[model samples]
Target: MIKVFYIEDNNGQYISADGSKRWTRLTGQALYDFLQTERGKKTHFFVDTDDNGVAIGVEIRNTELASNLKGDKNHSDYLKQVRDESGYITVSFDYFETEDGTSTGDEVIPNDEDSIENDVLRQFDLETLRRALDTLTEDEHALICALFLQDKPMTEREYAKSIGVPRTTLEHRKKLVLQKLIKFF
Candidate 1:
């Protein structure tokens, strides 16, 4: 069984654990050194005691949050007894199957065909959009850039006020420019 311990805040003494007829109290550098070990990584644990408040049992609880407190989710080799390997499966994948599947076909390696096609389509669409943007008039280009292409964009009212134009007129121009870009697409 894994060792467990709890802090005794009243005495300010690091009475680590006194369970199963074994008692250990540590403080200062000794406590720090003990924590550096594998078993002492967790800060809290459960300790059952008798009528005298003397520990007769120790418990180390396992939980997803507790296990991940040290950010050891990826590299941790502990907790193999209850571990389910299904966690390794990518949830974003379109399909999944157990190793003992009914299909007799040989295992196939994954290919990037879908990602490559998506990348090509994405690049083509960006190029088409750039070409469409190039056709806009100077004022339309400036308005579009202020609204959408900048690090920080301005609201329609803000852009309209900056250019000394009514919000309605600015909105109308934006709608027209978008319709033109759609037509180009």
Candidate 2:
């Protein structure tokens, strides 16, 4: 028997943004592990079965599912190899602290007033930002992380060309990402 896993809240209440039920099937366990560990959430996994009560696949709902929906050609073929070599697929989810150590409300403020520029940047909670970011598509997250979360940043044109998109499209995407981040603030 095969099982399908769908992610629900820690309490197992699964609902979409419109207050409707959402469901989908998970193909590969590697894909499942990528989402659970990378996103750091408690997922409610549901096993799927045939009419004969034989396990089949897992049901899932999230941006991760959407991103991998068509299944990349290489990745899909690779998963097939993995499934052939292994007898079973396994996946699990867990929750962990977003930050290391404890944060005290009494951290010292910098005396350099120039260091603080955007008011929105100053007021964001780390956990809230993380949650908001998780709402973004995988591509958007990857682009933003590549640009802002690196020591050396890629030029907009260079990054755009690398992704096979127009420079203007990249700029527009960056703007949208900034707007989403601002909403969290």
Candidate maximizing lDDT: 1
Provide the overall lDDT of each model, using Cα atoms, as 2-decimal numbers.
0.66, 0.64
Candidate 1 global CA lDDT score? 0.66
Q: Each candidate's TM vs. the true structure?
A: 0.44, 0.33
For candidate 1, what's the RMSD?
Answer: 12.3
Error of 2 at 130 (Å): 1.0
Where in model 1 is the C-alpha error above 4 Å? 1-95, 98-111
Residue 46 in model 1: lDDT: 43
lDDT of 1 by residue, 7-66 (tens): 434454344455333244554576568679776675544444356655432323465554
Q: Model 1, poorest ten-residue lDDT window?
A: 87-96
Cα lDDT of model 2 by residue, 1-185, tens digit: 44445543444455667766654434468445745684425442333346887555333446476446435645766786898899755332222222664544333434555466544455556678788889899998988887887688888888899999999999999999989888877
User: Per-residue lDDT for 53 in model 2?
Assistant: 72
Give the number of the best model, judged by TM-score: 1
